[model samples]
Target: MLMTTNEPAPAAVSDGMTEGESGALYRLMTWLSPSFPVGAFSYSSGIEWAVEAGDITDAASLRGWLAAMLTDGSGFCDSVLLAQSHRAVSDQDHAALSEVAELAAALAPSRERQLETTTQGRAFIDIARAAWSSPGLDAIIAACGGPIVYPVAVGLVSAAHRIRLAPSLHAFLHAVVSNWISAGSRLIPLGQTDSQRVLADLEPDVTATARRAAAASLDDLGSATFRADLASLRHETQYTRLFRS
Candidate 1:
């Protein structure tokens, strides 16, 4: 998962800039891959609760649930946090970084939600410091003097490595969606093909989410996914819960 000094920038990967995009592509895939070890498999972001409540009993319901997530829920907030974190890192603004982190931490609707984010965030930075050291990342580590949120952890690392923010954000969101899909597949007992089909249906929403998030400021941070938020809150006490959050 370590990106080499020789890796290309890959900013214009789609523009046919072959030289730099290879490294760029590699870094994006590595960070987003399930093998990165952030314990993503353990937390369902309340999807477990959604399943238990019968809100997501099948592919259609699951697709609708996930679509709102991408456009209106924590997805929107996390995307803004990620975008701002990357920008703060680029500008070397530790104060803004801290503010973003603090805001992100407090935005979680429940204790389990906070735990899911903080635990994963810390784990991401832990591996980042150990396996993918860099001056920019080092400064970010020193700045936090505490735990970083998951999106911020990723934003800073990508900024430090000179990975194009667009691709990095795209992959990050995609990874988030993929993990949810993986969870639903297990919970709903969805056939593999049906799961893939649901993911395919989400492509447009994912792109739109990224587009809107990149342009959003902190004031734009809000969640209209009340049911989803309530699900996370209730998930904290579910007696037969299978997920950590």
Candidate 2:
């Protein structure tokens, strides 16, 4: 997906900007897309346990479970971390970047959750560096020492590439919610149409959560969805499971 310099410059689109604002849009979609090789398909974020425990049995139930997560659980917390990490990188504040990176890893409620985030984080960095290398991206990576969580990696990359934070936040949250919906759809055995319906229904929630998180400070970082956190922990011991967490 690397754009060659020798190719002709992309033609501009009518939105007063080119496609996804001169390719920033395309980059965001590619990085967050389901096929990005982050192993996102393997992690259910605990939705598998929820299904086994009868917490999510249908599309509506799944919608409610994920709505709470987006608003109060890891979704919101991760968004905050991403927002702060983006700011830190934009400001070239290595200290702040490192702080959020550690916080993101520590906030994981369970070992599986930690693995889910950090494993994907490492993969994201490795792939992005190889395919989309840039001096700014490397600088952000160097500044963020210790464990790099998924959100932090996405945030820093967006910052390094000069992508606007608003769209980046929106795309990141949307991808998270979509992944959860996919997991629930499979666990509950919902039809594809039903799964799409659930995702469409949550559009408003996604937009609201992304907006709130983008403006939030690091001090606002926290998760209150105890049930979801417990679900993640329980997933570790479930004898039969389809997801990593």
Best by TM-score: 2
lDDT of 1 by residue, 1-245 (tens): 22233454434547565545576677678878999899999999999999999999999999999999889998878998999888887778998888887788788888998999899888988887788777767777677656688988888888787666677778989999999999899998799999999999999998999889889999999999999999899999998977898
Superposed Cα deviation of residue 166, candidate 1 (Å): 0.8
- After TM-score superposition, the amount by which residue 151's alpha carbon in candidate 2 deviates from its true location, in angstroms, is 0.3
lDDT of each: 0.84, 0.88
Residue pairs whose backbone atoms clash in candidate 1: 8-20, 9-20, 10-20, 10-21
Q: Report the lDDT tens digits of candidate 2 across residue range 107-215.
A: 8889999999999999998898899887767777987888799999999988877777888888999899999999998999899999999999999998999899988
TM-score of every prediction relative to native:
0.92, 0.93
How much is the lDDT of residue 23 in candidate 1?
A: 65
CA shift of 242, model 1, Å: 1.6
Please list the residue runs of candidate 2 whose C-alpha ends up more than 4 Å from where it truly belongs after superposition: 1-15
- Evaluate model 2: give its TM-score: 0.93
